[model samples]
Target: MDKRRTLTESALLLLVSLFVMISQGFAAQQVIYLLTAVFLMGIGFLLPKSVNWILILSTMPLCYWWPDIAYYLPPLLRILSMPTKRFEAATFFVYSATLLLLPLSAYQGIIVMLLAISLYLRQNDRAMTTLGQDFLASTDDHWEKQQQLALQNKQLLDSHETQLALQIAEERNRIARDIHDNVGHLLSRALLQIGALETINQEPVLEEPLAQLKQTVDTGMDHIRLSVHDLHADSLSFAEAFQNLLMIEHLCPVEIQGSLFTDLTDKQHNCLSMVIKEALTNTLKHSQATLLTFHFKTLPAFYRLQIRNNGIITNEQYPPKTGIGLQTIQQRIRLINGQVHIAQTDTHFQLTITIPKEPTK
Candidate 1:
């Protein structure tokens, strides 16, 4: 039961018991019964539910000894204040027995019964209110869980779609490579043979035919080259490719931040991928780093990549005297008209790269 409701019920019971004692005319015995009622009510409120049964049973002996029907009010009030239904049926039987066995006037018996009935109804109302609140709380929890599940399912579906797209791109690239290697080489060989025939031919009539055959082979080679280029370009999805790279096993934990929304040419994608790969490799091989991070950002005119590690680079490794890795990184950036900056301090090493949005001719 709620504390406020319990206090209210106890107060009402106390007031009613006092009124009944005064109406029946004050006596030493009446005063004692009132005092005892207050004491038992206090105990019922302060103690746990386990002690309630003992208090109720104690009331049985008091009722027989005192035989005043009004004395039963305190224990009945205690029963009404109880939150559990465990002792309800037994308590009702005990109260009914006491009411029937007591040799009291009909008026006293009726008043006691009416008060008990009213208190019982109030207890039922409080119980219903508590049950409704519990149901609402449970419903709220169920709804929140469903929302979380839906979000997780959406994320799962998006991941599957991205993987499927990557697989298709890979297959297309494979087909393009096969065509370029086999058919393109054969066409080139035929064109070369036709050129040699034209050079060695003494018959003037065969020269035009040889030139036309060489032209056809050259056209087929051009078509193969164009197709291969398209396949490679289509295969380079910067976001997906970068995510795949991040998934690779590394010595240190890597934190990735930022978003990829800018479109990149195939060359730009490959350049950035290689640069990132080399940087990661250097960090693993040279630095005693425990954590690595990659931050990517797209600016109005350029795409920026920042690779950082909480590791120190000694004087021997600072300028990179003999290593080809840093040199290759610099060379690749220059090819795409991008800038590279390397910074090292006592606590951290950072590599920043920025490539122009528009490719330079």
Candidate 2:
């Protein structure tokens, strides 16, 4: 039984017992009996569950056999609300004997039995209610813990992926540097040697072959340079690039929110980086902005970028008549089959970009 409900029931029973004693013309012994019943109830509610049956059995006979003290029986029986499974058979025998040996008439005995049954049912209901509340509280706690654990696991997985990507980028940069320093220098030296040999050869027949050799070395050097450039460009980290771009002095406070956990292709990264740089430059140069916001989101099939500022375009040249910057942004997005939306209101200017995962046409 819940402590508060047990206390409430016990207090109400005490009041009833006192009323009965007072109406019957208070006797010293009857007052003593009422006090003893209240004491036993307090102890029963406070004591451990294992020994509660002892208190229940002790108080029952006192209330049952004593004349005019039956008013205290309900409170004494409240102990039955607790689970006393081990002493179930013993309590059953005790109740049966007490009812059979009652000193009252048959009708009074029937009424008393009915009263006892009703009190047991009511207390049992209270017990069930208390049990249900506890179960709900425990279940809620379990669910909250499960949600927290799932969030932590996702964060851990994302961190691991980010670190792995960084490591791969670093390795690519190292390889690019090595190729530029060693293989590129060797190719350049080979081309120079072929040129020198061509200059010394005077025979007309050998001139054509030497020229072909020089062309082959030149082609090899060009291939190496292109390979090195591609490696360096592909290895650039979008996050680092964004941070570096934002490091420039700004007239307004910039708030960057949200992140894209999905991996982006090199072309997508370059496009976004360039678009953001242009937007920031325009905002700083043209608009009298107090706050700028950069927001990113990843959808099921697209990546979204939003650059918004709380600034008004007052100058006629703010969004130039030709709209060259906007056109360039559109062209870049079109290459990736993405969408760009530019909105200007009295209070704000917003640029929205949505890049689809798969090309449309």
Q: Compared with the true structure, what per-residue lDDT tens digits does model 2 show for residues 159-231?
A: 4554455456556667888998999898888888888888888889999888888888888888988888777
Residues forming the 10-long window of minimal summed lDDT in candidate 2: 106-115
RMSD of 2: 17.5
Q: Model 1, range 183-277, lDDT digits (tens) per residue?
A: 88888888888888988999999988888888888988898888887876445477777767776676688888898745776456666777787
Q: What TM-scores do the predictions have? A: 0.49, 0.43
Name the candidate that leads on lDDT: 1
Off by more than 4 A, model 1: 25-35, 64-86, 100-106, 122-148, 151-159, 174-194, 197-250, 253-361
lDDT of each: 0.71, 0.70
Q: Of the candidates shown, which would achieve the greatest TM-score relative to the real structure?
A: 1
Q: How many pairs of residues in model 1 come into backbone collision? A: 0
Q: Residue 290's C-alpha lDDT in candidate 2?
A: 94
